[model samples]
Target chain A: NAGVTQTPKFRVLKTGQSMTLLCAQDMNHEYMYWYRQDPGMGLRLIHYSVGEGTTAKGEVPDGYNVSRLKKQNFLLGLESAAPSQTSVYFCASSSRWREGVNEQFFGPGTRLTVL
Target chain B: AQSVAQPEDQVNVAEGNPLTVKCTYSVSGNPYLFWYVQYPNRGLQFLLKYITGDNLVKGSYGFEAEFNKSQTSFHLKKPSALVSDSALYFCAVRESTSNTGKLIFGQGTTLQVKP
Candidate 1:
């Protein structure tokens, strides 16, 4: 299985530009998550989905939006890119949400640079 | 709210020596804790997690962590350090009360194992 895969491994965007980061998992997972990693900081959650057609905000959901239209895809959108949003973004999926029973599988990550 | 902390910014250990990465967490209810490792320019990999049951939970790459409820600490350990073990370590926590399945992470600790 491909597990989890992300689009645009690296991207450079200007302020106010908009783009969507695509995440797809072939594991038939039930939960999907979006996170950003900044220098010296742990990965901060941005958004997540419990199942298809459901999306929820995470710890740092501002400046971002997400959609999970299909079971295999979760997309994170930046309406207006900002310098603060420039970081490494990762996507993860889990078969379930229960503790001990859930182990997340992560993608290779997408490096975004907002100029 | 759930939060995690990694006291040390970086740890240096020689190859073949024992290594430990400290972590502490705070939560109102029963806490679910996890440890993840991130290699340079790479996404995070799940090292281990403690939900319930045993105090010492073993995980991938010869890594293990001890979950201390009283002390509210979960420290990652490896009997013999390897150069390959040098990377960034993260501690995360989630309150059992919340059903959002969101995780709060620490500021991250860099692990440096020298040969």
Candidate 2:
């Protein structure tokens, strides 16, 4: 089983462009999250979904939107991308809650470069 | 708010030698700590976690971490290093309350295992 998968491993976007990153998990997990990794910044939370049909803003949700319409899919969207938004984005899923439970399983990540 | 700190920017160890990656945390309530490894252009992989149990937690790929309450630290360790073990290591923490399953990550420590 492919635990977690992300589409469009690499992409380049111009300023003000919009794009979507897709994440899918076959493990029937209830929690999903989007995070961006930057140099010396660790991984910052962009968005998260506790369950299907419910999405919430995270620490760095300013330039992103998320939709969790299906149980297995969580999509992160960049509306008017900026150079600051150009980073490696990762999607993760966990069978249990992010706290006091199992660890999160991360996708292969998508590298986005905005110029 | 829960947060983590990876004090070092990188850690170097030779193959067949022991290695340690330091991590410390702060939280208002009970804290759930986690360790993840990321390779170049890849997603963060779950290495281990500390919920509520023994101070020592063992996880995948022969990696382990020690949770010290008084010190508020969860340091990752490996008895023997492998060249393939070279990667970026992150420490994360989540508070029990208000846990939308959101994780606060550290700045990350690059582990370089030389042969």
Residues B1-115, candidate 2, lDDT per residue (tens digit)?
5778999999999999999999999999999899999898888888888989799999999999999999999999999999999999999998877547788999999999999
Report the lDDT of model 2 for residue B24. Answer: 97
Can you write out model 2's per-residue Cα lDDT over A31-74, one digit (the tens) per residue? 99999988999999999999999999889899899999999999
- Which portions of model 1 show Cα errors greater than 4 Å? A98-100
In candidate 2, stretches whose alpha carbon ends up further than 4 angstroms from where it belongs are A98-100
lDDT of 1 by residue, A7-104 (tens): 98999999999999999999998889999998878889999999999998888999999999999999999999999999999999987655345667
Model 2, residue pairs in steric clash:
none
Task: Highest DockQ: give the candidate number.
Answer: 2
Q: Give the range where candidate 2 chain A is weakest over 10 consecutive residues by summed lDDT.
A: A94-103
TM-score of every candidate: 0.96, 0.96
